[model samples]
Target: MKIELRDISISYGKRAVMQSISLTAMPGDVTAIVGPNGCGKTSVLRAIAGLAGYSGQLLFDGRALDRPPKKSNRSLVSYVAQDSAGRSSLTVLEVVLLGRLATLGLRVTEVDKHVVCEVLAELGILHLAQRFLVELSGGQRQLVFIAQALARNPAALLLDEPTSALDIYHQLHVLEVVRRTTQKRGLATVIVLHDLNAAIRYADQVAVLREGHMLACGKPEEIVRPDVVGPVFRVEMVSLPGAGNYPTLVATGPVHGSQGAASPT
Candidate 1:
């Protein structure tokens, strides 16, 4: 499935948070939303997931759903929140099995158990299936939640700051799984990222947002330049080639001005 957001805007009472934002996530690819804090990146994800109210068009596979998508349309998308690992007493396997609730009636059959185990195995957490959610570390819990989302078998996936609490190793590990699964399943995946380097390295396309509007959108390496990074993030970031020729973003320092402007090098 494909996701298209056209002229989208959001507000809370009288305060505006996003304006005229638009982007697209095509099946078999990863589309990332990158921006500084309070730039409406998370808000965009919520709007797409039909958890938040917004104005403008949100089309899934070329069809627009009524605002806050109906129950029928909800199953077409799976959302992984920034802090998806809630403090539940449920076991890892049970939490993951919850993803199949849309298709389950009373009990989990052998096939459902197989699917849950398969997803956990794919995420390299099958061994932890018997562990309680509250007993796992933050990274492990994050991976388990991701497994749950994948188990849903949705055509589109929305992730909000998925790597915020993860260590560097698991950060790469999770993104790698997301990219591989997105391609293998032909799923339209959209993620909100704060790390510019991760966006360039993992995403096929990147959309930059600033304040309340979209600053730019295109291929990550093409759009994540010094010009775009410096202004949107207010940091002196220079992109350099990393291992295997992947681009790496390094923040030299903060921009020195009351307005957080970058000094010309």
Candidate 2:
């Protein structure tokens, strides 16, 4: 399913956070949303997940959806939030199985169990299935949650800071797995990332948000350069040639002088 957000504006009472913004995510592609703190990145994910109210349209496969996802529609949209706090006695397998918790009835079907195991294996976390969520490391737990989302066999996968608390190794692992899964499953994936490099490496498209407004949206290589990224984050990005055709961005320092204070137009 393709996700299209047309002229979306979000607000609480009189306080408007987002205004007349539109972005699209095609199936078999990963779209990354990057912005500074309090820029409504999470809000955009929520709107698409049908958890938040908005003024504009959120369409799936060219049909405007006016309600939250229903099981009967055969449309599954999985959202993995940042504060996953899996402080429970549930084992990794059990927790991942709960991805279909909303759809399961009296008895668990073999197909559901099969999908759960398949996703775990794909994430390289099948060995940790017997381990308790509370007993695992931060990176392990992150993978477990990702497995949980994929287990739902979703058409669109929404993730919020999936690599926020991980080390460099785990960060790369999670992003790589996410990118691989998106392509393999032909899923429309929307991720909110704080790391620009991760966006450049994994995202097929990038949406740059600032204070609830999208400054730009397009290919990561074109939109993530120093000229475009500098004013949005107010940082000086020193670029270097990296692996493949991607440029490795290094933040030298904060933007200073009169131009430094200027915001992206």
Candidate 3:
């Protein structure tokens, strides 16, 4: 499935959060949205998931999304928020099983349970299936949330800071799972990430956002550069050779003025 956003704009009350944004996500690829805080990354995902009201086109499989027909849209897309507070009272398995509600239509069958269990296992959260969501750690809760998103078996998966609150090991683990799932199942995945390293390591394409505007979008190698990253992040970056041809970013403190003082842009 191909997901396209054409001139999309979103607002909260009278404040415009995102303005005239356009992007695309192709099947069997992982696209990472990266930016500083409060740059409308989450708003973009919410618009795509039909959770936020917006003006402009959200095209799924070449058709514009309709408001009242959100169920049909939901069937084709899964959204995993940064926080799991949306349905925390439910047990892990129950929360994961909710993904099947759209297709199952209030009927829960053994097959649904089987699918939930298999997804939990696949995400390495099977042991937490019977546990209350409140009892799990942050990383474990994130795993459960991702398991639920995967249970829906949607063509496109949208994630907001999917690795936030996770430890380094779990962060890598979750991103690896996302990468493998997209490749093996041919699913289109769009994730918002704050960590540039993780985005470069996991995503096939990177989209950099600045103040609700997309500054750059391309392969990791093309987009991950000091010239492009410095202005967006408002910090000077020194590129150093890494394990492969890709380079690592080292903060050279902050940009300085001619007077040898920190210059805040």
Give Cα-based local distance difference scores for all models: 0.87, 0.88, 0.84
Off by over 4 Å in 1: 258-265
lDDT of model number 1? 0.87
RMSD of each candidate relative to the true structure: 2.5, 2.2, 3.8
TM-score of 3: 0.90
Cα lDDT tens digits, model 1, 69-126, are 7776887889999978778899999999999888887888999999999999887899
Order of the predicted models by lDDT, top scorer first: 2, 1, 3
**Residue 106 of model 1: what lDDT?**
86
- Residue-level lDDT of model 2, residues 1-265, one tens digit each, is 9999999999877988898899999999999999899989999998888888899888899997646556644346888999984587999989998888876889888988788888999999999988899999888899899898888788999999999999999999989999999999999999999999999999999999988898889998888888888778888878899989889898989876534223233
Q: Which stretches of candidate 2 lie above 4 Å from their native place?
A: 68-75, 256-265
Off by over 4 Å in 3: 85-89, 104-107, 256-265
For every model shown, the clashing-pair count is 0, 0, 0
